[model samples]
Target: MRVKDFIWLSGLLTVISLPLSAAENDWPVYGGDNLHQRHSKLTQINKSNVTGLIEAWEFDTGVNDTFQATPVVQDGVMYVSLPFNDVIALDAATGKQLWRYQHDLDKDYPICCGSANRGVAVSNGMVFTGTIDARLIALDAKTGKKRWDHRVIGENTGISEDASKLEDTELGSVSGTSGAGINMAPMIYQDTVIIGITGVGYGLHLDAVDSDSPLGTVVGIAGKYGRRGFMAGYDIHTGEQKWQFDTIKSENWEGNFVTKTADGVELPRNITNEKAALQENADAWRYGGASAWSTPVIDPYTGILHFGTGNPSPQMEGSSRPGDNLYSSSLLALDASSGDYRWHYQQVPHDLWGYDVASPPVLFDITIRGQPVPAIGQAGKTGWFYVHDRRNGNFLYKSEAFVPQKNMFSLPSAEGTIIYPGVMGGANWSPVSVDARRRLVFIPGIHWPVEYKLHQQAASEGKDAVRYSSMSPINTPEKHGLLTAIDLDSGKIVWQVKTENPLIGGVLSTASGLVFTGEGSGELMAFDADSGEKRWSGKTDAGVNAPPITYRIDGKQYIAVAVGGNRLFGFKTGQKIKVWRLP
Candidate 1:
């Protein structure tokens, strides 16, 4: 059956747009609206005229690092955060610099990923950002001057004594070990700015040897090397923290120890061993790792905030942190006002495969079993698009696998077990876009097979023996990208398109029926939102590995994206923000 047959959209679009506050012509929030739909209502640049788009202007940030920020525009001014947490305001129409605030970094700090700030939040004449050194700062939107700054990671905040001691030992000398920091953009609700920390899921991440290739290997060292992850709310004007929610709960961190996923897919887990180790590791939550990797989408009417979490500590090795690892590798909902827990759905129970709910959640309304249901959808690294009822966290259905899947939950072996949709994900940190009118969700996905291998190093010459596991992309099956559109009502794939390289950026959909996304190959392409037809393509000097946003200034609509190549994925680095409009 056709997608439109299953999805009745005549009256549903009006209900979905009631609670969103973003203007029809302005890109106000990071995901285009509070729903995080990434869908614009403007149709000035529709599919028929998309091919006539020409470069309106281009601005250089002067810093060449991994640029992954989605530019936020309001009142003809654009606020964007660059690499190293530098925030800049630009004239939206002409791409002229208005004011720039340079963030000074500490000489030494901990960073799990490369230097990249996703974007900034603007509210009540102020711009807010979370720094790489774990600091949250607010700036004057007009003058670009600092208003207030708050240290997010306080002394012994997320740290444990045993984990700190491990950092001082010889084990800390291992390459690719990371520390705490924040890379996601801040989300502003009514009077509070919400942000989260990342890299707490400690693992050894070695980059590819070749500059033009994918990542080399991710080694999971078996020890307590990471701290707990959290999301907090701060006062907009004073930068005073209002409330904080730690991802891992201390007392009941050991969950039900389910041997399968919430969807009844049997996971390759040693449940008996996990239950046996539960009491011994009762205090494991102190160093538990469940990093918050993406900005959350809030339901204004219900006052509920929904977000996703990363992998557990000791990443690929699950022996150290046993049980279901409550809240990690799951989709969580909390009260927006109080930060109180609402409900959670663990996608991967006892996760040892590095399958994080890394992508941001998109909220919409869907028809399930002929009844209208308010729903939330998230693209998972496990290669499926999961849909659930937003009110109570009930599993509605999962879309067909967008990428190939083989031995999905297999354990790593000394001889190496190959798994598709591996660590890099069926979908990574890229945010998905939703078309509420059509009941379709667009996702940017990666298809790379990884070889999971276990290793043991013998004790020698004052060094203790260690066991570690590595996940490296294998050469077989060739890596590529998959841009898919799934029908929300039927949980079926409507259209799929393949690209030459793996996709790491986010997607944008417009009311004019055009879907826009960038590629690591330095091309910005537009597709027909319903049929997946190629509409247009443009080239840039660097890889367009960032989410695209659209806005209207005076009378014309413009599409903008950052053109900084991702360093870890071997894309060519750049420092340009390219804007285009119909000529």
Candidate 2:
């Protein structure tokens, strides 16, 4: 098919496949939309049909780990991602592999975090995703042939000054890795694909650099071509650079900007470039806090793009960059066209602890406080759920429950003073589901009190700071975790199921009004989306780290998940993706 014709047909199919209010037959993109709600309005597989649902077929991408991907469906094509950073597009109806694409990995698996990819994006005839090695590639939707690829991280792009300086005839020297290649899928909007990055070098225990850790980075790309990060964009049909937005220097930072290293090296400012969208908002590029880690959602009506900024680097400590780190770990509402900050809400101000607001924010209209309002919710690593009015980021009657934390981010919380609902949070990458009709945000929340310590990060000479990062206690006195159902509007607890570990996998909501999640003991559970009562449960090999996705082929509903041994939770390399039918 011609490019123009393909796009036209694809768009029409997208609209038609949308099951009016909700459809059971189609599962597309991560979280089911730019909104990432992960909810299906289709109720055919309800608490009843769900029992009769059978697994018709299963295709293993043979990924070594990270089943975090939610398959993207387009015109009966199912695109799924797996651990080891690979993507496969399959025939949605028969599970027949249509095409498989793999990125040549450099194999520097950052041990602290697993080398697993979240998933990919499909829009305008392209399949897009990032690599653990940091390349953002765009592939042909039908052929899986690499159309183009961009290196976002490795040594230096624009963000960090590298150990080796490149005297760019004009710009002089640029540092950091070649650029931290992408591990997550780029957010695909109409013509632009927005992406974020991760670096493993910010903090270290000196257990000696393990076999895994590599540098981290974030990127943005175009839909058609992988023009590269910074302000890279191209025509949706032709891989041509249309614009760029590069970071500005420190002197240009609008607000107080401070970046600290583990060894404590003070870096220079940036120069504005037309490639990135930050030239106009150059200061935004400089200021600290809340670096974006999760894919963003767009307000289809208002053109406001919502993304969660990651925790300030140097994971644990936050003594260096103070004040409400403008955008770090905050929900940044920006004008989609210009990348202008609309409004901001800092979940953890001057975040000393490693509280990255990296979870995808779910955008949906909800009735809150007895009034229906458009809302956006961010699930924090600190185990707190902050639901806000998407229009202005106003707090929607705190969803926090009394919990415990010890001197987190340097704030002395009196045990249960400001207890968060769950430490891993109301939602993590395991996407949350909301049934608009039911008016509830179905979340499999984590319950635990995360403790912190001052880990000193030093490179060679005096490059160090009082940075803060948090880790689950190796051996502690207190331990807790829980799964919760929340009313998006009133912020009331609909129901909560207690878990044995620090909140295992994610939750899946179906139009059939069922909420599915796994436990530490490796069980896939289904419950009434409205009441949170268990209807059925199935066991897996190990705890599920990834969430479950449901799709229908030949009119049969099959739920899929990744079961693996996560090092943090003491699960070995037991990684396997599993699909389930009602039986």
Candidate 3:
């Protein structure tokens, strides 16, 4: 064979061998594998016997806070993270604690928002977790003792300078991302542990003024507040920072100030004013706030990692920062070995709305325009599931709207503009699961509408000009959750199921022709993957706001999830990791 042909053959073999060597028994990675399919090959708990599945075991992590962890199972041990960054390893078959690692946060630490931890990553006998205090720690898998700890970000003041006196101002809750932390499950690839930061886009969140007023606003202050968010790779063995990729583009951060998106969607932007402001705020990228809130997926064969970026700094306020904030609110591909950018597809340029590409990207092969292509898909806060060419970041097609859409790109007005799928998005940081066999992707969505109204800072004794701003919220008649199944070939919704509350965690699919997800009301339901028919469900004590994972140990298939409620959403909270199996 020719030299080029030999090299091509070797690359193809490496990609194909991954699935064969992965073995369907363990869920070793965050999305179950490099593909982020979140689909398992275990069929012992098939749809036919799904109704017979019952709670097999339950373990309390000893903390009653927002538990959003998806447990990682390997061998017979299940490694999970709890509130406050604590971790525990339990026996997969029986809920017996093997070891526990307790993390103590600094008393003066400033947490930007809730204390929910997404999950943990286990690799080469070490367990990794990112803390709410902005630190990455490694612990021995067997004994749960601290191996090493590294401070990922600087001390977060949790409040900005200008908003310091507004702490007691009944106007709204202003949060600072000064020392923002991590909420995503650290990803392990090759010899590195990859993770990102959160809370960089600091803003004010106001609860509905009162019970009579359910439409509160989120105010975005324009001046510098948080630092530029980044994703970094670390040496898995020694806890050393290897490389880092800042989400916000510093150089050429200001683009052409285009009036529309690359996909041809018109934007509500004042181009002339923005262009003039660019020269004065040229250094805005230094404190740009596009956080890395979701875990990244790596394409093992090509060594490319795919992940989403958060909203830009001073989210909702575009007065200070100008130009298309290059990397925020976009899908990015990076070299796995070196944290170098490969390509980026910005969903919303100069994002004034908090429309973060928060959901993790899922990779799968799809037949686009009658041609099979490697693709990456992300369900956006904009209420669309976008598919793109994995190699070059080209927009292929987008799925139909899964949630309601009204006043989509409308700027916040003094009268409170109503918008669907507001700040929370049709899909939030919740992960999307893909079933390559059926060419269908499952999305857990929220249908909340927001009342976006701008509030102006009055010209006081020293200030001459009054600044105008608006807060975001859903101004809907009813709030609900949507579990949607979208067909890749048609970009159409196969079927959708609505629930009582907005879905927060994520979805899980199995080879047994089933898809499982949790609801804020504490019900874990299984549905027919193809038809979206509900098969069975069991109610937990608290909200099941986390992803579910299925793994086999001793030839028995088991499903597990964290059952603590979400604080931001006001769900009932607990401290339980519940596992179910067929009786």
Compute each candidate's TM-score over C-alphas.
0.94, 0.75, 0.94
- The digit string of per-residue lDDT tens for model 1 on 1-583 reads 5443433445554666542445677888888887889998889999889999999999999999899999999989999999988999999999999999999897567555678889888999999999888899999999999999999887534333232222223223335444678989888889999999988876765433532234666677666667889989999989999999999988778888788899989987888898888778777787788899999888866779999999988688888788889889999999988899999999997678889899999998877666677789999999999999998999999999999899999988888998989988999999999998888999999998999988776766656666777788876548899999999788899999999988998999998999999998899999999899989999999999999999997789999999998986778889999999988
Residue 180, candidate 1: Cα error in Å is 1.2
Off by over 4 Å in 3: 1-20, 155-160, 164-177, 207-216, 463-465, 475-477
Q: State the local distance difference test value for candidate 3.
A: 0.83
For each candidate, the alpha-carbon lDDT, in order, equals 0.85, 0.55, 0.83
- Candidates 2 and 3: which is better by lDDT? 3
How far off is model 1, as Cα RMSD? 4.2
Ranking by lDDT: 1, 3, 2
lDDT, model 1 = 0.85
TM-score of predicted structure 1: 0.94
321 in model 2: Cα distance from truth in Å? 2.4
Name the regions of candidate 1 deviating beyond 4 angstroms: 1-13, 18-22, 156-173, 206-214, 475-477
Q: lDDT tens string, model 2, 233-288? A: 34445444444332211343233333331113232222122223344333333323
Question: Residue 48 lDDT in model 1?
Answer: 84
